[model samples]
Target: MPPYFYKKRKRGAVSMNYSQAVNWIHSRLKFGIKPGLERMEWLMNQLGRPHTNILVVHIAGTNGKGSTLSFMRSILQEAGYSVGTFTSPYIETFNERISMNGIPVSDSEIAQLAAVMRPLVEKMEEELEESPTEFEVITAMAFYYFGSVNKPDVLLLETGLGGRLDSTNIAEPAVSVITNVGYDHMNILGDTISEIAAEKAGIIKKGIPVVTAAENREALTVIRQFAAKQQAPLYELGNHFSAAAKSRGEYGEIFDYAAPSLQLTSLMTNMKGRHQVKNAALAIAALEVLPLSLSEKEIREGIRQSSWSGRFEEIISTPKVIVDGAHNTEGINSLIDTVQRYYGDKIVHMIFSALKDKPYQEMISLLSEASDSITFTSFDFPRAETAENLFKAAKVQHKSFEEDWKKLLLQKMETMREDDVLIVTGSLYFISEVRNYCRKNFLEK
Candidate 1:
């Protein structure tokens, strides 16, 4: 029998099947973001400190962390190494959060793991007088699953929040990566760039190699100071490693990568946007600093195969529909720039939505340049801002509101010309829902 068997409810904690397990885990979101590693450390201890057993490549940043991780995971896999990855917010499914060799953990596997861990979690709650945050619990599960059942050659961990107190930070990484810090989550991670950089820098473990693409003077200063204090070798993006776009267009981009140890010309990546070149460079630099040796062919092939959905992901061809997760100002600005670079002359129709707490107004303003007409829509998420509120906040000349995204999309698709394009962007949560709707309603048929 599995360790998860023979579980019974104690003090209202009930044993759950797959769907029920997901719901129960998500219910802990009400505990909110607690910025400390004490609970994570305690939880790890209870789980036999599984994190210590696995080699980690820990990544933290405001944006690009997901894309960078994708690149690294691909590269590692291409090198014939088994890899485990932990990412956040699950673009499409909950199972995606924990993956072994790029395959998501099955629903039954998650359910069984949740059942086995429920009693220990309840014990912690009883002792601490509070439940762990949803992210913390998921982090614990990833560590346990990767450490025990699906032990891999390496684990790629992306921080759920600021690095210092983030649950993922409990693991000691062979290489620590900060993929350019910026303002997003200001309420949780301070207002200034330096302050946010400091939070990201917290993942720089003592004597570990630190790789970063942080370009801001103030932010770079903070990272440099932290790395120096920790005596960690620092690899700055522009200084130690860099990528220059050779050619970029609708299909994909080719870039030249230059670094201290190696240089590759015309490295190809199907990933859209010039910013992705930088992200790929960061991933390459990270791999370079790691103890392992990999061939340039493996690196190139990995980058070519690396694709992160919803980051300028094109869903359709004629009157092309592109979906991107550009929720914050920084990401929105990047999206705008990438669109301008590729589809500047084309008239763009945009479907946008955002969470209430984000700087959606600024995001809207930035997105306006890439869009000729914009429709503000809201998803079913509790924290989603209403379409009317987003419309009012945007105050764009050619703007409208639609409460239902599918209806809005269908309505717009009818009028879009062959030369025109439709872009769906904003919150990752919103994009995920809208993408699913498109698959079922538009793509599948």
Candidate 2:
């Protein structure tokens, strides 16, 4: 028997077993070319639109959406509302994409849900004569699960690639948030900032309120036009709300935020980097636009307690192994700025890799300015740039390159004294390999 068949037999004669369901998804799920609202509408219509009962918050942007969603989820949960959050391109596992009340769905629950939905999805595929994408299936599963078990008071839905065609746009959101716009997914969205902003602006529904961070003039114009056409209330960060850093040090950043209805001062965030402060501000602004009443004390407490891992995350502090998922130009600039601001004039050893589609050359060119040495590595993905490719790129910039990242990293750690920083970045996928290497070699307990 085949591997999947063998596994199914081992699990006993269940028609749609866990392994089988996973296999089915793997076989059917594909990326690219599928766009528009028709597929999601059809799926939801088939399922009776369970999202109508759930209070939804739609977040879209080229960057910072995930971190902002994290901040919002923490605050809402702290304020005693049951919350379900869905984010894409998970750092570790597929199950990480869906969370209920800030906890990931149980593996058995995911398996059971996949098993139940597999047949229905397949039937839909045949009946409609068009197969649903991987994202659509998982989205449907998340909506159904959130409705059945958590029935959350609020749901934070982050757009996958772009907003107009993203599966998460199906929800009639109570509030829509645009973190900021930048150049990414140009192949699908568009090449220009205005075109991309128009795609993201699709999440702005009629008569709904939108909270947006400060954006460039071009992107803001597109968003403003959309809001005007839809008659959605727009709250721009600097105009309608603002946050200023009260104090920042090695501990973390503390900022004061003035929202429409609430003023929170000295709100300390555990997340590192100055850009995180901006993400917090956007989350606070979103909360301000909501009808739910929250005291200043509650807002302060929520801001102080919000945590989002993998954004400038420090895994090991001894040799100072920092991992950040700064794959784009804007994010890379933020990471470089943060490192300089915190650890000034210090030499940084960088371990880097990126997806084939990303602006890897641009990212590397910027990073080369701050990095002391570069170690090229490959991540476990089909589209990941090979270590050899990265090494060649580093050579053009006259930077030192180590092709065997594992061996080279161990060598560096053994030779370097304290005070030197080691940064593992470029892609979140590579961070896992770096972490595993550290755990086996250096980290104890």
Candidate 3:
């Protein structure tokens, strides 16, 4: 049967709420690189160009974009400005992609908007020369929802893929942020570092200030050249701003950051990993250039209150279970560093999987250093690499290949003692599925 055939099952069904409507939309739409910005521009145009009404902080990079956006939203919200955030590839629900004032969009609201967008989306498919991709339609819906109700003062938009031609790059941002360049999506964004850097640097708009985390010399040079050409003020990490963690504990990390004009001391953040301190620093630097009214106190408080899930997240208490969406080599390296720092000399059981396109071999090589044993599993996505393929590549000692992931995870949990830690990671899709399973069976009362 065809993919669209599934949609026919619920064709005439009335969605009781927004959550259901979003589910229906996603059922029909697929994910991947549907290149070109014209379709997204057209979709937004149909929605009355909601991007113009709000101040957008567009962020792009191979990694750290989500963490940086989380920190920025916290700071802006603490400063007493209403903030909205839009991110991609949610861990759990589709609503996770859109937020109002730091909260996830409500189920009822999502359903209502889905109902309204359903007809428009269908019309576009029939009338327009080509149908907008899944991300494009959803991007339009998010902007419309944000504009229609409680128009926020600012919106932190994270790109779905490459920045230059990404669907989310249509907005004229107040400030652009690119968090370090690394080897990712090589097929689509070129195989060289300079090539990837150029794609990410596309987010740097003319005359807008851009804050970039410390990158390699070659990538840094490319970004600086782009900034100079665009006439945008470039704030590079370690030059204009820097951050270091003073102390780190199970609950959170304490860090100090210094931007060009603002200095903060011992800010508490619920996020783990030392890389997060750098992300927070980049966010502070970007906020420094914004014209919005804010104070140091607000920045400090926002840094403290910001929390993003599934980035080295410790879910369960006894026999501690951790989940991280470390799909790439860069992200896996960061996760490995955090594991070594926090759980020194402790053995770790790793549950891992990734997409077929990712550099799984490189990621597995790095992870093998920290992992004691591995339980390979696949996510419910077409591109997910199978357990057998991952197991063969890693060449690690493992256990039985249980058909059910939830059952397999629970069985592994039974073997783990209070001191042992199980790290569930690989792709965001696997992390999201594991998170949903844990919430339903283990975490929920």
Off by over 4 Å in 2: 1-17, 31-33, 395-398, 402-404, 436-445
The TM-score-based order of candidates, best leading, equals: 1, 2, 3
The better-scoring model by TM-score among 1 and 2 is: 1
- Model 1 regions more than 4 Å off: 1-15
Who wins the TM-score comparison? 1
Ten consecutive residues with minimal summed lDDT in candidate 2? 1-10
Candidate 3's displacement at residue 329, Å, is 0.6
Clashes found in each candidate (C-alpha, N, C closer than 3 A)? 0, 0, 3
**Residue lDDT tens for model 3, 1-445:** 1223223325433444655676666765754558788877776676677777788899999999999999989888887888899998887787889987767877776766676566666767788857666787778777777765557888889998889999888889999999989999999999999999999999899999999994689899999999999999999998888887899966678888886577888888888889988888888888888888778788888888887888998888777899999989999999998998888677788888889999997888888888887777786788898887877787555433443578778888899877898998889988988888788877431
- Encode model 1's per-residue lDDT on 1-445: one tens digit a residue: 1343223323434456899889878888899888888888888887788899998999999899999999999999999998899998898899999999889988888886787567778888788876788898899889988886668999999999999889898899999999988889999899999899999999998999999998889999999999999999999988988889988854678999998779999888888888899999999999888778799899999999999978999877765888999988889888998888888999988999999999998889888887899999998999999999999998678999999988898888889998998999999999988777777766532
After best superposition, candidate 3 residue 192: deviation in angstroms? 1.2
Which digits, one per residue and each the tens of the lDDT, describe model 2 over residues 177-205? 99999888888899999999999999999
**lDDT on C-alpha atoms for all candidate structures:** 0.88, 0.78, 0.82
- Ten-residue region with minimum lDDT total, candidate 3: 1-10
The better-scoring model by lDDT among 1 and 3 is 1
Cα-based lDDT at residue 100, candidate 1: 90
Candidate 1 matches the true fold with a TM-score of 0.96
